[model samples]
Target: MKQDLRAVIIDDETNAREALSNLLRLVCPEVEICGEAKNADLGIEVIKEQKPNLVFLDIQMPGKSGFDLLASFEKVDFGIIFTTAYQEFAIRAFRFSAIDYLLKPIDPDELQAAVEKYKSQTAGLNPQQIQILQQQLDTPGTVRLVNRQKNDNQRIALPTAEGIHFVQMTDIIQCESLGSYTKFHLIKGPAIVVSRLLKEYEEILDNYYFFRVHQSNIINLEHIKRYVKGDGGQVWMSDNTEIEVSRRRKEEFLSLLSDFYVNSGKLK
Candidate 1:
């Protein structure tokens, strides 16, 4: 009554590759292991040839790294689940990319969960959003635009090469709401003004990386330095900025933190 999902495994180590393939076949029999690649180049070739529905990607490889390989591709037709050996920065980068990932010495349960999440998210994804996600996977960073007011109309222009100032999404500490305007606090330079509501930006940002921790603040989970608990809960950003977690959003925030750490395999 269900369909089989085709998958390919890409890892430099033969043992790891085979082990993952075997595990998938054993636990998730519905997942067909189409092929395996020992390096990024070969993996890309196989992916192009097989066109599987999913890919179990390894972060590190011989010639090109997983990130490099992903960047080279113009489009990603398959869902990706990155497998790595506990690199904190890479994991954070993947989180920012809004892609599903798993830690090395992979657990069957976690792998299953990742697959399920992928299925749900991709089911109703719009073509534009898919394109945006693919673009972000290849080139990850913050986006800025200019707003112009003429008469009673407003026009927006994409930041140009001459006027362009690029900031990594991870560099964003928090977004502050002032009246109808939102100010972005970055790791460098002055905060920029954009004529958009906090809710608007929140909707644009991929939910896997950013969370609405409070009514006025949306914090990047990767930038959270610490979580301070007291009469009310608060999160400390990498820049030493504090953000309140509203009582209404407390449970959801805690659940996100729990899932993040759990998926990273810091918790059993």
Candidate 2:
């Protein structure tokens, strides 16, 4: 049942850990507070000794950062829910990377959400996801995501009722807005609906060969079959879907497509 989830809090701040403990005690009764560590040295030791299922990690510590502690471990089998005050670019990176985090001063609702994600996930954050996090932290704008499910029995975690959807970025044709939700049209399968807005994906897929052609749709340039003629015209996706290209995005889309083709040496 994955019940009685053992957890350890690894933060440099005493008050921060105390506050988290209080919140967990109030909201998440299933989680057992097994241990607490002041810094990375003690954090590493705590995990080695206690062997908890979850670790509430803080990004900034005294000597070795949270990242450094993660790097020290060869394989991290426990789920990590980061508590960080890193704003703007870092947060954007986490959104695109699909890594769970709670910004400080932590929100109770957000903490509960993170715990829910932990319950759903069978294995914790692997080295690859941690690497992606580090890369995103290093290069803020690059939203290159790494998923383990291209060949293995892994799944890309999308915020939808269907839960983990096994999808590759290249296979996604376009995303259409459906009021509050977004529908993902794929090249080889039926469209999958997610409980997230188009704008959320727009930002996540920004540097990942995706562009907003209209207020309604964001198309993958690699999967674009052809561009039909009109005032603003429409883009014909490989999946036989024709998405209207907004007048404002026409020139920009074309220019980027041109650049893409040239760079790939397909424009000759």
Candidate 3:
């Protein structure tokens, strides 16, 4: 028989906590509401006392934020499903970190899905990946990752069968879709294969100069060594690998290339 997951809700809002608790009771029968807290400090106390299997954490709190709560622990044993009303940048950060989260005014179905995901996946969360999420959240200015300075040390967490691989975003040359899995080709090491769809990454990397020229391939604009024009055209990457561009996306790809070069002062 499957075991019940003891979960604690930690949010600044009493109503939010109550609503989540009520929803858990209504939908997820395998999850037990072990404890609840209104802020990070009390949350820390409750967590230590309860020693829950899962925590439904809110990103924004009165005193200490959700990240602050996690920072207090040297190593997190419980699973986290962040509940946030934060902006798009935070959402992107979460995805890049390979962390699970639910949006505010949460849907019952999504909550159930998150709980199931936690149950099936491994227990330990990567600290460096969490740090990457926090750094991206703290970064100011435009959300377009391409606009950011190249040396900003941006990283991403790629979850594979063995464990999670944390790699610098700049190190990625391209991503190729292999059915449900995506293969990440890097600049310095062997490619890492993740058990995730290409579209999931395409959405996040699109803002960071990573373009999906073909359905199966997403290449970094910065790593394009040369382009050969044809019906759809083809681009040679810095690693000397050739990738074809989709016919329908030809114009858009060329336009983006023009902008990329102009912005970098290479085509002034």
Candidate 4:
């Protein structure tokens, strides 16, 4: 037998909190609502008192946002499921950080799915993952000025057999597909192999400087040392590894690289 999941709902809106509580009672009988709070300050108090296994946190509130509430804790021992009215960009950040979130006007199916995911996963979002999410949410500009702060802030969460690894996006040279698994070749460390499919990562990395030169390979444009031309050009990565660009994708890859150089001001 399993234990009931003790949960706390924290939202500024009374209706939102009530709605979520009622929905949980109906959809998730296994989840027990132990506490509720209207603001971050009261939320902190509720969490400390109840020490629930999970928290359904609303993103925007009167005094502090969900991110601010998380920052208050030195270590988050419980799981989190964020409730938000944010748009696509924030959704992308949540995906990139592997965090669980439900958009406003939450659908029952999605909420149930999120709960199932939480039950299956070993742990919830760690501090590093939260930081990555916050950073990605803060950065809205497509073309940002190069700086150490930006580089340090840009990280993605990779879940492996060992645990969830938070890595700087700039450190990744390329991603290689090994059947269902994806291996990350980094600039400063050994490759990290993740259980997820390559296509999933391709979608996330595409928003950054990554380009899929082949079906099995996605290279970071910043890590391209040289491009050797051929029927399908081969690019030498910063790791000194040569990767072949697919014949069908060669033209598009070149175009993207040219655009990258122009936009990045690296065309000297």
Tens digits of per-residue lDDT for model 4, 1-268: 2367999999998988998988898898899999999999999999999999999999888878888998899889889999998887777778788887999888888988888888877766888888878877777534222321233347889888898888888898899999999999998868999987899887676567888899999998889999999999899998889999999999888888887787677894
Deviation in Å, model 1, residue 43 alpha carbon: 1.1
Residues 66-141, model 3: lDDT tens digits: 9999999988988899999887777777888888889988999999999888888755577887787787678633
Predict model 2's lDDT versus the native. 0.79
Q: Measured by TM-score, how close is model 3 to the native structure?
A: 0.88
Candidate 3: how many backbone clashes?
0
Q: Which ten-residue region of model 4 has the weakest summed lDDT?
A: 143-152
Candidates' TM-scores?
0.49, 0.75, 0.88, 0.86
Q: Where does model 3 exceed 4 Å of error?
A: 1-4, 140-152, 265-268
Return the top candidate by TM-score: 3
Write down the worst ten-residue block by lDDT for model 1.
146-155
Worst 10 residues of 3 by lDDT: 143-152
lDDT of 4 at 5: 92
Best by lDDT: 3
The count of residue-pair clashes in candidate 1 stands at 0
Stretches off by above 4 angstroms in model 2 are 60-63, 71-75, 116-123, 126-128, 142-167, 189-192, 255-268
